[model samples]
Target chain A: MSFEVEDRVAGATERLLGEGTPFTRLGVSEIANAAGIARSTFYVHFADKSDLLLRLAARAMDDLRDALDRWWARRRSGDDRALTECMLRVIDAYRAHATVLAAVGEVAGYDPAVATVWRARVDRYARRLRLELEEDRRRGVIGAGLDVEVAPFVVTWSIERTVAEHVRSSSPTEDRALARALSHFCRSTYA
Target chain B: MSFEVEDRVAGATERLLGEGTPFTRLGVSEIANAAGIARSTFYVHFADKSDLLLRLAARAMDDLRDALDRWWARRRSGDDRALTECMLRVIDAYRAHATVLAAVGEVAGYDPAVATVWRARVDRYARRLRLELEEDRRRGVIGAGLDVEVAPFVVTWSIERTVAEHVRSSSPTEDRALARALSHFCRSTYA
Candidate 1:
């Protein structure tokens, strides 16, 4: 029951953020009201707006990590269709939470705590890519001369920034094409 | 001259943003005072803070475009040193305007006008890369089947996002290595 209420609050926040309302404009009362809960109920689940945002971002991160795992698995299996599916799933997440993510991206600029947390998320993704790149390089699956450290950083940020920009646009590129192209670039660049 | 005052105002805004002061906290009177100008003078130039930011972003975009042009020239001439120099120049511009850019980036989330302008800048950069990629593909420079439309989008966002994140970092990666790695990735990806 607690988790359900928390999910409802999270969903309400995401819906609000997704509407192009500035994160700053989102009040706790509004969120609680939208979630059909008492204002006091919001405080029970989260300390503040930032805390709520952190929880929302954490959920998105988990979904994103799941998508990335699929990418790794499909790529390892050499299944293009599965790889593209994974990419689309990730892109869909970006599209679904475009406003929320954009708000978070904006806050990271001036908010040190947010910036640290955001960078840590990217670093976590990069760490996984680095491990794969190292293994690939050792196995002669990719060029030996590629900068192992930098390659993963670029790949992770490339997809990240690209998707972020895509979601922000009113007319985003077709998802399948973006997925195919992005996956192709990462594969060719690293593999 | 008016231009000199505008530059001072722009510099002050960048400094203020870089100091982690939210744009909402920056008053026009404070801006004018920081620029050593009368509040009236600020109005004589910029209509509002957004106008000042657009000017700042325009300047950064110009410098970025110039650096990209150098990249094209050096790559065509097969001058690795020149290529690295151009990349370093671009990186330096990103670092110098990091705060202004970050502030602009933040505003872009909820402000349709800012978001449109920012995307246009990225689109313009992507357009140039597209044309270049087409020519390169026609000349058998890169693989023929590479997605011409999508490749440049990825490349432009890759550089734009990478540099933006790089500038935001407290412990930024060494400029030279970042330059080399980024240039190498773009060159290899598109050339």
Candidate 2:
């Protein structure tokens, strides 16, 4: 699909999923209606609902990576405010794509393609975290006894879980509190 | 359904899921065939596949809770070895019922019944962790500045994500190592 077409489909998917419908039970006609395209036109861009989901899943990951990259670039100077802002921005991006993230997680084991994308994203994030930790260690911000491998896993998994909980919770304030607590924990645990 | 019939169907469901065959695609018929029961007999016990899943999800939670309870009881006096054993046992129980747990998680948002069961189980576990944390706080074993609510969520979600990663990993040794590292992280974080 062309970039414009893919962007349109992705926008429609975000709206549809944000409406909180069961994606598995959604039909082509529904997606077409949601996208403001003819049912026949839907087939021109995708094979079926699953195909659309696969595309959307890929898009979500790419969008997430882009967000992270932007955050990393914007925070290259490593000020505390920059770091906190970047982390919160990343969390917000995840929240915006929460439904798709949850679906991708659910199917990670059953779908090889999805699992590969998911694992690759996780590994990339882990590497980024490892680099950050190594920098901190070199600067004597963190204890020398920190195990490099385990620290990354802990940070990645902890951040992921914190975001997942925030997305699933009903209260926005709770999520804010959670993000603050997690940011503090991350700094304290590592530093 | 009679108690005996429910028990029989539950056993059959457990067996079919444990096998993890392509027959999963055929749904209830495959389960019926594996159980040596007729389709009508299957329906007599479960209203539908979701009903069967509800039973299985409940059973998985109960089994996990029982295992944890037994482990906790055995370690009521508290020792490092007992703590390690309890953590491993919990991870093992999660691995044993991963499929059902995954299914429950997938359907949770769409199905109120399934969501209720899942939330209840998670809440129960969280409550247990809270009690333990409270005891530790009273004993001055953990830091005074800890946020009580956030601590349990962190510990619970961390262990959960660790077990999930362990189940998805190809190497058993890596899984064990991750589990051990997670247990260690929990000890230090909580302490």
The candidate maximizing DockQ is 1
Chain A vs native chain A, TM-score per candidate? 0.84, 0.75
Candidate 2, residues A3-106, lDDT tens digits: the string is: 67656766877678777765654567787787777888888888766567677777667777777776556543545566657767777788777888866765
Alpha carbon RMSD to native, model 1: 3.1
TM-score of chain B of each: 0.83, 0.78
Error of 2 at A152 (Å): 3.1
Instruction: Put down candidate 2 lDDT per residue, B1-191, tens digits, no spaces.
Output: 46776776677767765565321243777778767788889888778877888877776788778776765564434465666677677777878887777666656645667767777777778789788778877888776546677767766666666566666553555554555555455555543
- Candidate 1: misplaced stretches above 4 Å? A1-5, A27-33, A36-45, A76-82, A170-173, B1-8, B20-33, B36-45, B78-81, B170-173
lDDT of 1: 0.78
Off by over 4 Å in 2: A1-8, A66-85, A131-147, A188-191, B1-12, B19-26, B67-82, B138-141
- Interface CA RMSD of each prediction in angstroms: 2.3, 3.6
Interface RMSD for model 2 amounts to: 3.6
How accurate locally, in lDDT, is each candidate? Answer: 0.78, 0.67
In candidate 2, residue B19 scores what lDDT? 62
Candidate 2 docks with a DockQ of: 0.35
